[model samples]
Target: MLNSFDQKKQKILQEIQSDDLDLSPKGTIDELCIPIINLINSNDDMVTTSSCSGRVSVYLEGTKSNRAVVSKGNHGRWLFVTHEPHDLKDWTSKINFVYTSSFPDPNARLILYKFEPLILHVKCRNLETANKLYQVAMNNGFRESGIGSNFNVAIRISIKLDIPIGYKSPKDEEFEEDILNLFVTKDYIKYIDQLSLERFEENSKKLNQLYKAIEKDLSNGTVLTIKTNKPNWESKEERRRRMVKEGLKRQEELRELKQDQIQ
Candidate 1:
């Protein structure tokens, strides 16, 4: 019988394999994040629940909405977002920023450009495994990583951007490019794009360091090296059964070796 962990793990994997599911704003996993996610899931003692490779985003926030009061961190929605280094040219032609708020304060609502870092959540087989992941993650520059007293570890990068570009309407979701142009210039938007790209590069590097560290730890509990390929995964139960079977055959061989050593 599959335990709770195994059931959850299987469900998560199935979700990954399915094309019909849309759990996040991205609608699916980020391609750059796939290898790392696969690496973690391939381990017998761990599975990734959620992950993001990192992204550059244009976000629109509603400061006066009831939803804003309830969810302070996510009181906004994405106007535009990209998992790769964002190009202003691609976005400018596609997204036309609009505002309809006529509040007393110009800062009442905001349109933001963001560069976010790797965000990963994992479920481990046990508390020990969670702590092991936490230690490796922190060592690899995931300063915001944490493991609970139970069996989950969330790895987060320290660097992220929430740069405000302009204001958006809290009530209505329409305005015009003229409103955005009134404040932010094309050159300034280009500057934001350049800065976001730098953050994206840094984020990718950090994610690589983390997964390599995790892979190293899982392989031998010591020794670290960058791996260029995926590993063949085996279930923990299967591994245990194989070890026990091998031990039976090796018992007589082990006795002979001890005798030979003594002689």
Candidate 2:
């Protein structure tokens, strides 16, 4: 007979495999983070509750008041979003609508772009397991990781971007095209998008490192060998940079193997 913890683990893993319980808009696992998620789930004591590989997005914020507390929810709020790094042209196409469109929400105050890094939430069989997993993750590029008494471990990485793309005055009925254009010009938009893509590369490296560490230290070697790549989603420049990085990594691994053989 299985103990309570094992039963709980089995139930959660079953739900994950079923695909019917998913309430998320995307309704699927992130492609890049799948290796790590699979590795973590292979552990007898852990099950992942959520994970995001990363994202780049443009958002429309409701009006802010000095006296009121900041609150957030997304529905009509996201003007643009992507799980992968995007071409500058993808964002530029939306620039015309910023001032020209008849928006439903007159309370909209700002348009901002952001790149959020990888996040993972896991439920452990016990507090000890959670702490052990948290330590392994924290040491391997997820320095912002946290654990709780509830036996949940959260892997929170730090590579990120949050920049203002455009904004308008609260007193104005509509923002002037010239004023908004100064802030979100084609050149400026491209600059910010490129910068966010750079951050996403760094995020991918950290996530890969964290996954390797977890697989080695916690997964008991039962994790499947999953190839995590989405070549179609990458921009030309982004692909070149990632390839260069991979080449350097291969060279480093070869050098280490030579050292081991010498020993």
TM-score of each: 0.72, 0.71
Candidate 1 regions exceeding 4 Å error are 63-75, 86-90, 97-107, 169-182, 220-263
RMSD of 1: 18.4
How well is each residue in 59-174 modelled by candidate 2, as lDDT tens digits? 65544543232224321245556676744356667554444333334344667778888999999988878988989987887888899657988889888777766654333347
Which parts of model 2 have CA positions greater than 4 angstroms off?
Answer: 63-70, 74-76, 87-89, 98-108, 168-182, 224-263
Looking at candidate 1, the ten consecutive residues that score lowest on lDDT are 223-232
Best by TM-score: 1
Pull out the clashing pairs in model 2. none
Model 2 TM-score is 0.71
